[model samples]
Target: MKIPSEMSERIKELAEAISEAERVRVITHIDADGLSSAGIICSILHKEEKQFSVKAIKQLDKDNISELFSNMRSDLLILTDLGSGQADKLPKNKGVCIIDHHQPVSSEILQLNPHFFGIDGSREVSSSGLCYLVAREMGYRDLSPLAIVGAVGDNQDSRGELLGLNKEILKEAEKEGLVIVEKDIRIFGRQTRPLFKALEYTTNPYLPGISGSERGAIEFLEEIGVPLKRGDKWVRLVDLTEEEKKKVLTGLVMRIVKTGGSVESAKVLVGEVYTFPAEKGMLRDAKEYSTLLNACGRRGFPGVGIAVAMGDRNENLRKAESILDEYRREVSEAIELLQKEGLKEKGILKYFLAGDRIRDTVIGTVTSMLMGRREEVLVGMANSENGKVKVSARTTRELTNKGVNLGIALRRAAESVGGDGGGHSVAAGAKIPRGREMDLIEFLEKEIERQVNEIDG
Candidate 1:
């Protein structure tokens, strides 16, 4: 594909770096979006027959950074989805190219994010869209399918619109028959799976019965006699009997409009199951890869996730499944811990600590799950693999309506403690140095208090 004339210079620079480098290393975040971004780059490298390795990391800590720098055989390192912050920790090597959409920590890093051009990086555009920019620069338009997958994985299309280059790429993908664009309502409330299996997978709209057990969810579905699956295997809600459908539909009335701009209504249907055909043995049939990849990262073995995204098969798939099961178990246990310990609601900050094993990957999901229970801002913190404190902050539209920006507050708080953090204004995260967890929490509390006071005053 021809490079967009506007980004031609930057694209040329990236291509030159790739052509000149002896070895290349790609690092990305450990979520579905991150994996999809990594997959796009990896696919390009594979087609070009370039020597490279991919690493999926939860957070760029001192140990991981040190290991990456020490083992650096590549003349160039490309970081995607992450690395907007940590400019200080960025490898000093001359051959570094970063493609991301997050708000950067400093002007120098900010200049690298495509959003600086007034492009919407939040959901309208994603890290994958940014990577698509890089690919367009490299003259590989054929890889746009990978870019679309990354965008979708990142929830970029949840609102029924695509922004910036993503729209252009979607048009291209549609022309190539790689993607089918349709106007449809995606149901985010209640799973049609069995109670035990729903608890195991923790699919949205359906919290497990053990932790935030939605008794209403189980009763409504059971009274309707809808057969729920054991695991996350998709079941058609439309397949249920007419009476069961009415009961299940009647019970799923709690509308969960996320504050970060996903404000769609949910509808209960009896025979409206939508499926995507599998792409090259990957579970493209399932639209939940984003959640699955996140579970993999939270449970450990982020590399297994990278392998799956990179299209590894056989043993790699088995390992990924095993790791995901362990992740479910850990999440169940963590929810139990959160319930016993309970969460504290202080002004705009609602939080609970789930010991050292919970980590940041699960925080976002858990926080979103708890949103139905409370209308306050949500913040969940856990310890990282390096013993440092990891924090994920989320807010509802109610809070955003008051002009509260959790991302800015969390970034400032994390930086005040000499840590790295930044994300969208509605949702964000940070990793503080070990032993500074309380300091970070206190800082966030004060910031939230200040924001509320300023608005009220």
Candidate 2:
């Protein structure tokens, strides 16, 4: 675990600031990575007998930021998972440490971000991974598992692999005997539910015909000769024999191709999956844990998400479970809406405008779930309560190889119309004025076309 010289200096600065502070407050985004980063820091502070409070917000708005700055009662403020993008909007407060992986903004406050070290924040690392590295450098080694879970939460492991600094965190977890990584089917409900039902709910790299239809999933399994039961008991994905597993994957690939789905999507059918040997229950598996956290965040129960991430298993976990159920229900319904309305094609992109029918937070998830290779860019828009239109853009992983950075494109496009935006290369989002929808789209199309040509040229 040799630390890079530049990152080593920043980590040391943050550790020292924590040592000198009497009272600290942790602020993080509401996503799984944010919750995990808060949980990890909370644990570290608790162990060291430091005074701290953790808060998770959906986004940092002007009013909320002002209130936090005005009500500053703590000696130190640590912003995680966010605050890196809109650095200009942040308050000029001393003793502030922002640990984030998103694109950076210029400010005088202490900042430790992956981009600062020439690292790819979107795929190679997450805010939690960065925080975990800081904690590990401070000699808190047991928190490695939570950091790994946080990386998975952020979709850094979407390609069925962890890269760069994330790989280092995985190695630390392995040495501590906390995790076991295997090359297996990377479905959501593999260990927790029946095989058919698992396939029915699969969304990422979403299986076309079999995804939302239980009957279709069941038929696929049966056609593939995978035994649904043995000795009168239904078998889950974890129960399948290696031979049966291979057959199942082969069948899924063929099904993807037969349904006119992308062969690249079919190639994403099987990959590395991580399992926790010590933790129990559904969240014990990394992917399931991430999904539950996502459900909580999208449904406005981020506090409960943090509680569960920090090991609160009483009413909070039950409440989170209920939230997850409801979240899935909403997502399924929203997906149905999009499927029925369908996407409107305009030149190189396709889109669905849900207006006020869908929440802004859920639009991104829905866009990613329904994205296909046929459309170079997929956009989903919903009206938020704040008057601005929230837009989510998604592109296929394979398409990103063609030199498209949706995050970068979306940011520039949104800014041209007096809005704000940014995200990863594959998935990005923006907030824009209500009347500028078409203008933004046209700009995005042109930018994407030019970027691709420049890369290919």
Candidate 3:
């Protein structure tokens, strides 16, 4: 796994810029990848004895961008995991560097996005990976695990494995003995939860009747001839035999097909599972580590996530673990709400209006989980502060290949309604003024249909 020379040179230049700055101000998103990116850069800067300040935000909008320039306290500004798509809105003489993996708009600001080098920013690399490359150029290769965590958090490993620059970072982590990768059942909570609980919580492959039902998961396991317990000890996915694992996987595929899901969706169930040997409990697995970070951020404790990623395990890790429990409960409650109150359909899209019932931060995650159960694009909306609505949309990889870019569509729709939005093709988000949800949905439907029709022609 060799680094592209051009990208490597760009990373060196960014490292030089960071070294030359007297003081740095970092603004990162309030998500796992964003927090992971902040942890890497902040740790490196601290080691280098550089003065820096950091802030974690939910999104980059006009008000925050204005505040960033008005209250300037540092010689340089670094926006990680975000800001590439909003580059044009940033000031020109502010000494800004956008270290992100999202698609970039034309701007004069310095950016280290993989999209500029013909790399698939959505799938190949993430903001954390880009930041890790900068850290590597600065002689800090041991931070590879954080990069892997960020990539997994961003769902760049949707193919059940890391690819492109992410794979390159994984190789570095392997060399440092920080991460070990293997093929296994790709579900949440393999390291922390019981076997049936893990099966009940699976979402990517999204077991139809078993996913949200504890009894269903138990019955499915029993039907597959895999005992729920071995002589009084409950079975974990980690404790399954090779033959038993195959049986469970086969059962999963059959369940998906029986529920009208494509066989290709079930293929994601058995792929690379990343283990962080140096970490304990849930932190040992890359996906679970990312989930912990997400829990911290969504629970309004982004600092705790950053601290855990920066090697803090005393109070911060305990707080993060506590937050994870609460986050899971909130997520389950939100999902139950969706199940009780079905989504509204418009053309090829299905949407739900949470209207303050669901937290805006959790809407994107909730929408992603529900996407596996439907053929139409899933859109979720929740009330935000300042009388705004936050919208998160998700679609299948199959539809993305059919030229349905939710990022572009949502951006256009948001701007039409005087809002802002941008993200990957499969997942995107927006925040629009209140009383405009209907307008946004209508425009989004047209945009998605147009994209598909153009491709069909």
Candidate 4:
């Protein structure tokens, strides 16, 4: 839980820089973690009455970087959730700051990242957690809940519970009475949706027939002797008794195994659920809150997500609910389309080209949801604006443990094809020319094979 002395000192320096800046311009990724990071920094800046502006971007690529800062006026620029991998592209004329957890390229800019201190950024902490450490150094620790939400959003809790610095942040949230951590069913929408709907909507584990099947979920519950409702009201997961919960968990594992899924899929079924009592509906639960943030950000409403994270529960929350419905529908439809069309397998990867059928902004989310369905690394691609292709790649912890670095591979592969990419060992992304999808895939296939063989060699 103790912050490394060097990391702590770095955070302190960043805090000081923020305090001294006359006007700050913040550019963050347009995802849950990025939005949460933006929310945390912006909330503190708002409290201090500092002049600041924010832009949520899909990716910190060349055109994006040039457009976002060509006419920069702020005294300081802070890039959150992103900018570590593209540090060289950042403007050098201004005081640039990077608070991110992605794998970093060498840079001289003022930055704070966990990887620099021998920590696993992918699983240990998230960009939001790093932002919270800065907030803590700035004497604002109440933002811990947002940090936890970001961690969850990044799937840092893949083991069903947070680890490393995230666990430390959870402690801060708990101590401040802002969060309640409990071990419970780790399905989506546990706080708001009915039990059948929650089971039907879960795609992380891609639960056999239950996922994407309302009738299947209901039948599974009924077959397990769990009642569908309590006195005519459909029960939520929270409404179940301890005995019924155990039965459901057991049934879920059995169902997954029976349908050819690894028991490992069930690892994510039950874990620590962080609840914020002060917040209502989906915002009260860390997973659901993070999902809501993702819904807003991915659907081109990053401001709504940021506002909700900054404690706006009226207009922004209302807008976010609609976005959530749309986002979920799109995700379900995308998954069904992918499943129906099938994935293409190469030497060491399974991939699909959405060809703009899926939005570029949500391709990564789709790729993640499609992870547990296969053993090979999954690569998802979608056509982007301006004749570009967006690529999102994901691998399991097992493959990562076997020395499969998607970040390094994708970075090298993208660079070879006149693009840029890098992230964590397990998950990464890139952007390339429109017709270069196959080139990217070919490069990844060879690189992954070499990586796997090198570890064995």
- Please report the candidate that would top lDDT against the real structure: 4
TM-score (all chains, Cα) for each model? 0.79, 0.94, 0.94, 0.97
Residue pairs with clashing backbones, model 2: none
Best by TM-score: 4
| Model with the higher TM-score, candidate 3 or 4 | 4
lDDT of 2 by residue, 1-457 (tens): 7567999899888888887788999999888888889888887787778999988876664436787667788889999988887777887788677998887767887999888888889888888888887788789888787888889887788676888888888987988888888888888789888899888877776676677778988998888899878888888999998999999888887877775567766655677777888777777788888888888888998888888877888899999989987887688778877777878987778888889899887888888777667447899999876678889898876668888888789989999988888877888777888888999989999999988899889
Which residue pairs overlap in candidate 4's backbone? Answer: none
For candidate 1, write residues 346-423 as lDDT tens digits.
Answer: 655677775565756787766655553334677788776556777888765467667676767888899889787777
Candidate 3: where are CA atoms >4 Å away? 201-205, 208-216, 257-261, 373-375
lDDT of all predictions, in order shown? 0.63, 0.83, 0.88, 0.89
> Which lDDT value does model 3 have at 451?
98
Lowest lDDT 10-residue stretch of candidate 2:
58-67
Q: Better model by TM-score, 1 or 3?
A: 3
RMSD per prediction, one decimal?
Answer: 5.1, 2.1, 2.0, 1.5
Over all chains combined, what TM-score does candidate 3 have?
0.94
Report the lDDT tens digits of candidate 4 across residue range 105-143. 877898899999999999999999999998888889888
lDDT of 3 by residue, 1-457 (tens): 5777888788998999899998998999889999999999999989889999888998897756897777687888899999988999989964789998887787999899998898988899999999999999899998999999999999888888999989988987898888898888888888777889988866555577787679989999989999888888888998999999889999999998886677766777878999989888888988888988988998899999999999997999999989987887788778778877977899889999999899999998888877654357989999999888999998887789899998889999999999999988888888999999999999999999999999999
Model 4 weakest 10-residue run by lDDT:
367-376
